[model samples]
Every structure is written in C-alpha cells, then in structure tokens.
Target: MDELSVKCLLHANDQVILVPSACGLQEMVNKMNDFVKKKSVKVYVGKTKVMVFERGESTTECDLIIENEKVEQVKEFIYLCSRLQIIANMAEISKKRMNADNKVNGA
Candidate 1:
C-alpha cells in the first residue's frame, strides 16, 4: 500500500490525521507540517507522537523527533475501536484475537 492519502476527519472538537510515510519519518513529518501550515491549523505538539511499524529492521537509527522530544514508538495501537498493529500480519492478529476470545470465554 502506498498510503499516500491526506486524512482529515473532524469529530465534534477533535480531528484525526493519518499521514503516509512513503519517504521517511522526517520527510513525512515535514510534509505534515507543511500541510498543517497550508490548512492554517495549529498542531498540538505535546499530544503528538510517532508509531513506527517495521519488521526485521533496527529502529535505533530512526529518530522521529519533533521539537526537542523524541516521539515514542508503540508496538500495538488502538485506532477507532479496533486494536491495530503497525506491521501487518494476519496470522499473528488471528492468534491474538483467538487468545483474547479464549481468555474471555474461560473467565
């Protein structure tokens, strides 16, 4: 997936942004900042963080730094109401789902 879409969904008083990183993290952030500037919206930097999804790669070199603080990387994230992993693995997701179901059923 190219993931080259500008997502801007407004809900009540909050908005969501889903920027694709076809280039790199820094480039994506720059692109997002440029986009925000064009739209004349202020980005709440304190509330913003980066979630990197990659497999079999060292992320030590990836510095998703905004301002002076480095954005934290998360393994799993909840978007909307569903739990989504950054890396796409159908089997893993299915297994995790089954485990959750079993735990619930067992209880």
Candidate 2:
C-alpha cells in the first residue's frame, strides 16, 4: 500500500484461495472501517481503488464501496511514476529481468 498515492494491494494465490465477490469485498471494507474506528483513524475512502490481476475473465468493474462512496476499478494505472502491473507468470518476470540486464549491458 502506498499512502502518498492512496493505493492498496490485495494479493492472493488463486490456487489456494478465492478472490472475494463484490459483496464479499464490501464486507471486507466494512470490517476495515470498524478497525479504523477503533484506532481513531479516518480512512479517506475517496481515494480507494480495487485492482485485480488475474489472467482470465475477471470483472474489471468492481462495485466496492466504503461509507456508501464508490471506489474505482482500474487497469494499468501508474503509481509512483511507474506503471504497476502484475507479474502473473514466472516466465514474464524472468523475461523482464533479462531485458533489464541486457539494457544495462548495452546490448
């Protein structure tokens, strides 16, 4: 989670657990709200976003809400001046590393 950008990351191994449905996500936010209230910290719900990085027919339009305020769903959003994308596969990560090394080696 990047506080300055007001972004959060929720990751899970798809094989081990199920990604929550829209209703389930709402329940999570409600729980989070309760926790925040206990700590006396206010959550800036306006900046909240929901990003899902699955390689399938997943819903990009997540109707997640906090305090009845709608949170946005994004694809390929830039954060901290860098495009943040999910490295879904091990091969992709290896390919990216190879490319970076080649560039540094002036190839």
Candidate 3:
C-alpha cells in the first residue's frame, strides 16, 4: 500500500529495513527492486539477513526478498557491541545465581 511507511537506516555498508506491517514490507521490497536497478548497486544476497519481531502466540514468519534473493533469517543479531556485551553479562550473572542457589539447596 502506498499509504504505508517504511524506514531504511544506512550505516557503513549495512542497511536496516523496518516496516510497520507485513504489507508494508512487501511494498518496500517492491520499491527496492527499482532502487537497486536505478542505483546499479550489486545485491549482496548472501550477506543479507532478516529479523522479524512480533509478540505473542502468532507463529507467522516474514520472508524478505530483494532482487530475487531470499535473505537468511536470524534469531538474534545485535547491531551494537555494547548491547551484546550487556546481554552476555546478564546471562553470566543469571547462570552464577542459579548455580549458587542449586548448591545451597543441595541439588
């Protein structure tokens, strides 16, 4: 739909595509086809990754394709090194706490 909005974030050689809905994503992909051809930029299909973030029990999966290349789906891909480190530290703390609790309970 033309009314739908899509956002593209460019950082270095990477690009982040965001859409409000699945239809918006389709619209963005359609526009990107024209954009790729017009810009004459080589499509790096192998390097492309897609991450779909949704809430609750819905099991619907969104597939992102650009220039006829299907992008790989990732469970988690952190853009910020600091954020990733924080997640890692949190996991370590949780593990240590669980171990201490188990020892105390003699489990």
Candidate 4:
C-alpha cells in the first residue's frame, strides 16, 4: 500500500490544506485538530472556512471539522484582494460605450 501525502500551504499564521479526495481531506482536518491541541494553540474556528474546487457537473462534498465543530463551506471567498469564485457562480461582464463619437466623419 502506498502512503498518501497531504499537500499543505503555510503562509505566516494561516494554513491551507488541499487533498485529492474527500476522505483524505477529512483525515487531514482530523490531524490538524490533534496537532493544535497538542501544541496548545488557539484555532479561530469561526474564521476558518472550507472550499472544494471542482467541475460544475461534479459535486464535491466534504465535512471539515475543527475543534469538533463544522467549518463553514463557501462557494465564493475573497482571499487578499481577489475573489475566488466557483464554477457555478462564474460570470462575464461586458461594458458598452457610454457615448458615441461627437464629431461626424466628413466623407
């Protein structure tokens, strides 16, 4: 059996974990809960959120728990200044010209 590794990103005091499957994702969450308790650190559960990026047709369902509490799942979340939108909520905006050329062309 091959040992699967959890892919994680650490930036300052923030941590981001990405797993291939829902099961793996849940396992990682559980591990994190244990780690925080052992280190005697506080986890801002209310500020924590979980998001699964997948195709529009595919529904990726996973329950993420922190400190025995379920974390909020959001379709679109703003990270830094950019907004992370899901496929279902993705849209395109087009801007039309407000005014046409004032001067008429001399033929």
Candidate 5:
C-alpha cells in the first residue's frame, strides 16, 4: 500500500506497533508479550542505510529522511518503507513457523 494508507492503517490498528530501526528491535523480542511480533524494513539507495522497524505488534515507527526530497514526499517514503518492513517480517516469521511446524509433524 501507499504511505498514507499505511499510516492510516497504523493509526487505525491497535495490533500494529512501530519502533525505530536504530533501536535494535530484533534483539528485544524476548521482552515482548506473546501478542507482539518483530518487523523491519531497510531502504538502500546505492548503499545508504534507511530502515524502519515495527516492534511489539502495536506500534508504527516513521523515519523518513528528506535530503533531496520534499517534506510530504519524505513522509510518504517513510510510511511506505516502514509498512513494507512490517509485511516482510511478518511473512518471514510465518514461513519459519510453518517450516518448524512441518519439521515437527514430519519427524
């Protein structure tokens, strides 16, 4: 989805959470409750690091940098990047969980 849609969704959903990518959300999963999950999205423009993270399944963090871009444009980019990360992370976790479940069942 686009940035505005993503932001709207985040504001609307109580289950979604956001955290800054610099906060090391990946290393803090154990402290999270069972209802929460980890999500991360990274943006690289020829090696620059621009990343966003959603942690604890209830927050949405927006970190949009405006260098050559306008304020509104940067805001959208930030929202989109963060939302993408959340989706990607969720998919990854789901896949891993499925694989683990399969292994246990097949074993």
Candidate 6:
C-alpha cells in the first residue's frame, strides 16, 4: 500500500476491533501507546479520541504529523510496514513468487 493508505491504517479509530492477520496488533498498539507516553505526543485516529496509555493521558491531536514535508519519513514507515507484512506472510508470498517464476520460466 501507499503512504496515505498506511497512514490511514495507523490512524483509524473505529470501535470495531479488526483482528490483525499476520501482524502483531497487540505489539503495534503497545508501541503506539508507548510512543505517545514517552514522547508526550498527541495522536488522534480521526475524530475519536484515543487514549494511548491507560495510566497516562489521551491524545486529541497528532503530534507526529504526516505532511508532505515529511514525505520521506512517511515513505520509510510505509516501506517498513510493507516489509513487516511480507515477513509475516513469508510462506504465502514465497509460494506465490515461486509459482509466478515457474510460470514465467515455463517450468
């Protein structure tokens, strides 16, 4: 996915709990919370206020702004997420890649 899509995924705050497939959702949540708590950063998932740390405070706005000025950083984050997804689904991806390679090579 592109940077915007990745950002959207990170910023979504719907009540519906999406069961993450291969990615560690709990770890992501914990890291996100820790980022806010440690950095004292404000974060918001749309209009819904997100409480980063249970014992800390809530983030009404995003301190880590995703603007055009930070395009490189955003791209890096997106690349990292993509790499994580690939690592998480390595077996499936390997199979697909092998199949495609075989087809291309007429094997």
Best by lDDT: 3
TM-score for model 6? 0.23
- lDDT, residue 51, candidate 5: 38
Error at 94, model 2, angstroms? 6.9
**Candidate 6, residues 39-66: lDDT per residue as tens digits?**
8764343333222222223222323222
Tens digit of per-residue lDDT, candidate 2, span 7-81: 244443111112433436566567667887899876676655567776754456777777778877766556445
What C-alpha lDDT does candidate 1 achieve relative to the native structure?
A: 0.61
Whole-model lDDT per candidate:
0.61, 0.61, 0.68, 0.67, 0.38, 0.37
Rank list by lDDT: 3, 4, 1, 2, 5, 6
TM-score, cand. 4 vs. native: 0.68
Best of the two (3, 4) by lDDT? 3
lDDT by residue (1-76, candidate 4, tens digit) is 1355678877777777766666666666766777887998878989788888876633666678776788888776
Off by over 4 Å in 6: 1-23, 41-107
Steric overlap count per candidate: 0, 0, 0, 0, 8, 0
Q: Count backbone overlaps in model 2.
A: 0
How does model 5 score by TM-score? 0.23
Candidate 1's residue-wise lDDT over 1-107, tens digit each? 14555557566535555655425556667666777778887666666645555664425344576655676655655555666565466776799889999999999
Instruction: Give per-residue lDDT, candidate 4, residue 20.
Output: 68
Candidate 5 structure quality by residue, lDDT tens digits, 1-107: 11212221344222233443434433332233222333433222233223343454534443333233321211123343463334445677799789999999999
- What are the root-mean-square deviations of the candidates from the true structure over C-alphas? 4.8, 9.1, 6.8, 7.4, 16.3, 15.3
Name the top TM-score candidate: 4
| Error of model 6, residue 98, in angstroms | 47
Give candidate 1's TM-score: 0.53
